[model samples]
Target: MLDLFTIFSKGGIVLWYFQSTSQIFTPSVNALIRSVILQERTGNHSYEHDSLRLQYKLDNEFELIFVVAYQKILQLSYVDKFLNDIHLEFRDRFKNELQSSQWFSDYTFKKSYDNILVAAENWGKAQAKLPKQMRTFDESFKSKKTVASMIERKDDKDNKKQEGKCLFTLVGKKKKGTNGTDDDLISSQEVLQVEAPKPVQNVNGDVFEDPLMMNRIKLAQKFSGQKKKADKQKSPKPEKAGKKPRVWELGGTNKDLATLERTKDKPEDEGDYIGADTTLIGKMKGGIQDLEVESDSVEESDEVEEIVEVNKSPVQKKSGGMLSMFKSLVGNKSLKHEDMLPVLDKLKDHLIAKNVASDIATKLCDSVATKLEGKILGTFESVANTVKATLTEALVQILSPKRRVDILRDAFEAKKHGRPYVMAFCGVNGVGKSTNLAKICFWLIENNFRVLIAACDTFRAGAVEQLRTHMRHLNALHPAEKHDNQTMVQLYEKGYGKDAAGIAMEAIRFAKESRFDIVLVDTAGRMQDNEPLMRALTKLIRVNEPDLVLFVGEALVGNEAVDQLVKFNQALADYSSSNDPHIIDGIVLTKFDTIDDKVGAAISMTYITGQPIVFVGTGQTYTDLKSLNAKAVVHALMK
Candidate 1:
């Protein structure tokens, strides 16, 4: 029996639903919508959340979703057939209402759903009862056998005819020999022994062997001797050097260590991020600055429109174009998979060229093909134009964030409750996790928010000192006298070789006690494949429970971007040992300025984790951080 069946609009309005049990399945269904549907992973056949496996089909023409959920342990073969039957039935019955946008109206689909489900179950049973087909001659391996192999050879036939025959008869049935005893007869065989012939010698007393063969033997001996000599003359391997611990440029001595040490009870002085006379002071009004990813001119959209119109014009022709496959497709005819294969292949290649992961590109193209497979084209619309437009829309929709990640507003809300907001930055090694953390810290302090930098990256040798250096630089920029002798930024570090999770917990406590507005925990940069380090990261996030968990990744990556994000998320979910795990909440894409037009990493990252890119690091300075613009990224990708 099905646990639940539902039909909903793409906009998330439930049109009709039936439940066989009283158990609430809202969370499971919503997870499917968010992780699979919204993430453009509909190419997958089923989505498993908790113990319920949800299978769904999309109604592209009507913008509807039909879903059926059941226990994962059950092998319900009829679910797919039932979903299809009910989808067609419901769509046919409500065609008029759906065409008129009456999706919100109450739908009485229980009777039709039951009839379809029963028929599907019966069909499945009938299929199970039928005998499995036997393999035909062509399907069997015998069909591959050659006639020559099946026939017996003449030599084999002679060997078989000679079987059970002896070279000598039993010698007249054992003739008697000496002493009147039965004796064996002499064998009918002859034996002859000969000595080896002596080598022939010439007058010079040289053997008559081939002169060239003798010469070759002598040369081989000479070469082998030379090789042995060369082996003995080889030099000895060098000894390895001892490893030296890294020394930071700003390394502190014993005397300076006292000043660097921080205590939780120490009171902080109040100050803003910038000084009154500072040049950047005027630009600090906004809580967080937005990224200027898109062009300032509005004419770019007009140019895009013109290009699209040109593509749609019949006068323009492409050799072996996408429309060639659809030339036989007449007006008001439904599109088929074969009709869209050529265009999908081209689009897939286009996406891959833009640095999108090959798997993601293929899936995206498959999803687009699925969407357009049954839709009809207009009278003047070419298949190429339709596909291009649909692909553009899909790209835009994918890049757009489903939910806003406003750190400044959340910080103010945490301040109102007199608690510090915590944000943890995590990612693979060398992806600039700490650098971007400092950038975010700068932004937070610029908005007059008291910020505490937590150095939880105890694994990296110079991580704490790096944060310390950034803290010093930011403090110099915003001195205590800038706002009534208050210090705008401070660092809380317990040195290296400490438990990062413990340090984060202590830092959050210290921030709260010290009345800081936010605590930015800079975690160690570790590769996602490092199990021990990944487990440590999971423990840190699980223990600290930061207000937001940001995965810092480099935009310069191509296929590796998918592996990093996927393994990171998988580690969090698998190692947390909780029903509700603390996975990555958002992404911080660094090195955005480096990748000029290959912005597919943004799409790949978002698609894999279903998280928005909250911060983009465009340069080395703290002010280089900016928010991600979906449209701008989509434009760059399409170009």
Candidate 2:
């Protein structure tokens, strides 16, 4: 049974509603609108919020919405037919008022709604009563097969050749064949006589001259010779040498003890840390706001304008890039499933070519087809532009961030409260987790914020040294002399092979006590499938509770990357051992410059996690870190 049914205008006005329960559904409905409809995920057939399952339909021409809500456990079938029937009935009954801009007037549709609901329920019951039918012979694969294809032929010539070879010395008689050919037939008594011969001594005076014995001896000798050769080819092992400790050239000494002493922490001096300078802050902001992405060559044409124009169509453009090709199929009438299949298929291919996941592209095309069904296109309007516009809008909505992460502003807020802003970087091995972490740290320090890099990546060799080198370079760029004898950046590391969670916790504590502006935790790069490593990552995030947990991923990934993101998010949620587990907060897309226009990874990551991409790593330098610009990314994708 349906729990709620509603009809409303696109402008937030509830035209009419019916409910069987007193439960409040505003929150659930609003969630559907925000997360699915507003996010351009209309290709999805149903949405589950709390215990309710909601299905919605959009009336593009009339600017109306029809939604049916029911309990999640119920397997409802009539709701779709019921919604369709009611939509047509209500539109036909009130077409004049709908077109006259009289939306605020009262609608008396109770009788008509009940009749349509009952008819739909009856139709569903009838379908259930029918028995399952068997498929016809023509529908089976056997019906399409041929007998000739199933037969296997043997080669008589090869068989005869194999039989003609003599195996041993035997007495045989040649008989005259019918075709004047010779046929040899062996005699059993003669074969036994030949086999009864005695063995003879060889020239080496070592064993016997029997053919079987000689062959066995030769095989044994060959194996022994090969074994000796293998032994001779083996390389000698080198002697182990003593290990030496790594030395950093920037390591402090007794001569700099005075300068280091002034940088020491005091309880009451926590609030005295200097904030980021204005010039550096502006530079950081400009980098993010003005991020440049290379679009496709097709972008130079008027395609972008066409896409934008189609989006403004009366029905919100329920079309994709191929709508123009199939415009003749839906001329002067409502679109059916058959009419839209070719167009949707073409759109799906287009999206896949644009680097979208195959499954995701199919779903997006289904959604566009759903939005376009039962809508009539104008007689004189260009269908191609309309289709392009709708697909472009959906792509743009998907790329748009649901929530913004203003790191600079938030860091200052944390500074004012006399605490350190903590951020942890986690991802698979060699996705540039440490490299991007360094880039972000550079950006933070550039804004005059003192930063601490926590090297908790104790698993990989040289992880600590790599971070130390970056710390040294960053400090050199902003030396103590330029910052009133105060070091701009510091490294907190406990060598290698320690507890990463414990290290992160200690680092955060030290940063707070040292009055540092930000603490960037560099975790070990681990595969999503590694349970031990994933647990350690979960422990780090759960215990330290960093302000941001960024999942660093390579943009040069495809369908496999989807699995990686899903597994990482699932591991974080499953292993947190808490009712309110914290998963990935945002994404840090690495090697963005390498993938020219294959920006599907960005969409896939954001769609799976519903988290915004906070930082994009375009180049190898620290200055290459920038914020994601949704429009630029969409432009590149469409191109």
Candidate 3:
């Protein structure tokens, strides 16, 4: 018996297929076979593996007819005749539909073609039962009537009815019992159903009879009884008398001030140091509100001294006391490398947890440690505060770029020169290259520059259509104020299966001729590992060098973004002959809001690549692009 049959067009696209009930070829296997045949360009061949055989015939038009069957049952002549008939019928029937590329999902066409395969299977079966002398192809299936016969029509109908019965049974409908009569199968009248049993009631009127529910009720009651008994066993203790609140002595009283004045006039001694509690160091730790020191009495001095209001709550007081104690212990000692080791370790762990590359985290920690060694500690300084200050300064220094491109200014300058400021966006697949390109277009339009989006992403299936959708949305949201179609925000697509580089070159020419200020070229998404695709991207850049090449990537990719940028830059350098070698001038991080806690991507990417992030995609809108803020990113990481 013929087990599997498939047909393919000249370009290796599947046109139609059929499978027998015994064994079927997987879609992937079918695609593999098609790719092999298309690549090898075999005319007619038979391949055997184990007990199965795969035979295919290529027609004059390069259309493939493939059949998979068991080796023992194979009759080459009969199979060849069947294939010829199928090809003739398919070409004659689907002639008009095959001329277009959009006829893959025609349901009526599929149904009519499927019936022909049924008739062929039926004819094969009938020929198998005949004597050897009478088994000629012409004798068995010469007439049109014979070719139109179907043996599985009744079986197909019965299968559909059984499917309906299974669906009804699944959805709580009553099924026909084994002893059901013919009337039972045909009747549509409603049958009276039995009512469910009433649940048993307990003494407390709880009506649940399910065993699991009964067990839960018993367990809850047991826990509640134990909780009540435990609560009764505890007794209240007598409250202790509260201590008097400590008063903070800012300056002395009037009498003490006068005595201090009298003593100041009397003599000078070497042993006149104040105690730790009354010194300036103690006041700093308690959070200084005010401080005053005078040798004259309050009446004599015209300046009225403001007193510091200390916290009265015991917890606050206790915390203040602990701070004072710590300050006194470490006030005079210089910070050693040993003192900061624990803090640096913790900082390294924090950076790694936030998705910073492991090596980058180590470098950051080492940098901070180098700056902190042999540093003097003030009375109120703590290790955590020092580490934060050092880390912030280091990150800010790393994130600050040496050269920055003001896109708006560049566009205005290009317009003054009567040329368009072109920027090409590239990235790995599904990283939102096209959407972010549209975002940049919207940004340019808002900045008073006439913009055009070039939909040069022709490799992917629906790349052109996706760009068109974006253009329509952007036009609807922010329509051009004063311009014709040439100058307004328009999409230029050469459609799919065309050379992307050629499309981009033409787009730039179009922009120059149309006098647009900026042209944003969107390229197809490809993986960094795909050398052929990456080389094509490099060619696109080399042929028509854009003013800026920005790498668009996902923030959630973390350290992997670093690898992508590096490899892309290397590819551009290796392929392009330009003196400046097409490197990523900037990065646009997409889905920035999705990576809630892992925010080290921005820091790691900037630090590793030395490329500043230009804008971040925060939401799905034209106006959702936000300029990168270094302080905000640092704060988020530290938080």
Candidate 2 C-alpha lDDT tens digits along 545-565: 999999999888777678888
Model 1 error, position 32 (Å): 4.0
lDDT of 3 by residue, 1-639 (tens): 667677766566777776665554564345445433322213225655445667665553334444545454566445656666677776665565657644646476567556665677777778888777856565565544543465558888998886444111111345576677443432234432222223778899987655654454445445333221221366788799799887877756777775566332221363322121112111112111211111121111112122235585332122221112122224545567677676677777777887887767777776566455546667766755666677877776666664776887787788889899999999999989888887777666655567778887887888887777666555544444443543347787778888989999988999899887888999888888889999999999999989998989888875686688778889889877776677888988889767775678878777666777887887786656776767667666765
Extract clashing residue pairs from model 2: 43-367, 276-447
For lDDT, the strongest prediction is 1
Candidate 3, residue 44: lDDT = 28
- lDDT, candidate 1, 533-608, per-residue tens: 9999999998888999999999988899999989999999999978899999999999998877778898898888
- Candidate 1 TM-score versus the reference: 0.71
Q: What C-alpha lDDT do the candidate models reach, one value each?
A: 0.78, 0.77, 0.66
Score candidate 3 by TM-score against the native: 0.48
Which prediction has more favorable lDDT, 1 or 2? 1
